[model samples]
Target: MKYKPHEQGFSILEMLVAMSITIGLTGTLFYFFKQSQDSFVVESARTEMNQNFRAALDLMARDIQAAGAGIPMFLGPIASKDGGGTNSNPSLNPPDAILLLYGNSSFSPVTVKAQSSYPAPTSTSSTIYTDIPTTAFAPGNYILYTPAQSLMQASNLTDYAEFSLFNLPSTSAIGTVSSGGTVIGNQLTPSTFSINPSDDNTYWNHTMSFPSSTSLRVVPLDEVIEYAIDTTSSELRRNRNKAGWVTVARNIFNMQVRYQIETYDDSTATYTASWIDQVNQAATNNRALIRSVEVTLFGRTQMSGSGDRQGQRAIAQTLEVAPRNLNLPGFAPNR
Candidate 1:
């Protein structure tokens, strides 16, 4: 069919304009789509990190609460001395004589103290029965004597006992000098003998004494529980005593631990929460005790490009754990 030259298909300029508009629209849509994808990736990564952090914290809290369970009492004995020492008595080479009592099912009101026979070792293999004054030894000194051995073992005695300063009571009873007895340079020694005159009469020559006792009573609580990150491989690993430290989440960047301690006032009947280290110091000085713990975790997205990614996502959380022995006198829970 005949057609005019003006009625031809699209001219070069028209085609160019059309292509330009199509490209512009496509570019705009592509930009928006890319942004949406990035946002989704970031959010997903953040969510995963949060879940991982929670799982880790929960695992830690559970284990910490279970610490010293079924374990020997002396294994978790409170520190009585500031220096290093084994938990065995010097004379008996046996385990320390600290007694542990769980006051409640929650294991929170626990008590640890030295047994009456703990500080002395008998000479004979048979059980020795002697009412030795608690004043014979220095207060807070780690005493490890066996009931089978006499407290006054001869100098010839070898392997007489094993003793560590850890987990001994902060205070001890000592013989008083007012009743013709003397405390010789913080050492309680018998100077004279006294008799009970009445049925209700007990020896009036004993006094409570306090000496340097530095020992750890509770195990320290871990903040992270478990967390790991590999920037080179873009992998994250975390575990909380589950199935042999299995990985719970990936692509983590960092993990941190913060602690909270509750300080109690006997006069006011009030409690205050403070940081872990601060509480630790106070507890060590017999000022306050640790009551709770908190944990925080941070993570990042996996790398998809060779160069560094300008965008990053963070996940954080906090957990609170109440420690055992919170209300006990002179006892501080470690977290």
Candidate 2:
């Protein structure tokens, strides 16, 4: 076909304009895609962080609640004094005295042993064994006597006003036996022999000798479990059993512990609860009678950025739990 020929190619200016428009459209699409990707990353990191924080807190709370729970053999009575001692009174002398109500330390001198001298007495009076040899005593051993008879005696036959016996050796040294019968030793003597209602220091100390004395002195048994954040590495660490701290989570920003002390008032016949910042220091002495605990954890995203395309997230959680040591009578609200 015979037809007039049109300009075959576009001008240089037309080509340049077309190229610029194509490039602008491609750039806009790429920018939007980048922004969407950043937003997804931030949201995902935030959700994961929140989950981790909650999981940590929940685990802590469950363990705390199980503390000192079940197995009455390990824990003493729930009440401290039971209408026997005043707040000002020394906890060592409670009205109702019981021996080894709470399990002693693994190294405790007191222990329960099989009775070689059997035909176990049916009556309380028949069970009394006077003039018993101290060498025969085992840890956790007990003899039932009318509260009046000599409850305990020293190996040397020295009269102890009131004494408790344990299979464990005395922490203090007063004197030792060489070859002869008796040598002077650093024996802990007590003015009164009775069980302290409180688990405080009044029951545990080097001042009172067990097995040789009847009066109970409060012993200090403090256990610490802490979770801290490391600023340099941005990690979370836990220290339980007080051996040393070890990192548990990287990217954790903060961790905190809160305690609750539950107490009963005999006169009012009611219970009271209070929050404690810490339980081991002198400043928190009153609060140190903690029966429950609450833990809070905070974590952050590992990355940094801005806007939907590049921002990070923070997550936090709180949990509550009860400690085994603080479940004793005077410290527990329900007990």
Best by TM-score: 2
Stretches > 4 Å off in candidate 1: 1-7, 68-249, 262-273, 278-288, 303-310, 324-335
Query: Against the hidden true structure, what lDDT does model 2 obtain?
Result: 0.40
For each of the candidates, the C-alpha root-mean-square deviation to the true structure, in angstroms, is 18.4, 14.5
Models 1 onward score TM values of: 0.44, 0.49
Q: Global CA lDDT of candidate 1, please?
A: 0.34
How high is the lDDT of residue 66 in model 2? 44
- In candidate 1, residue 228 scores what lDDT? 38
N/CA/C clash count, model 1: 29
Compared with the true structure, what per-residue lDDT tens digits does model 2 show for residues 142-246?
322111122121111221112232222233311222226543211221122233223232543322222332212221122223344555676666554335667
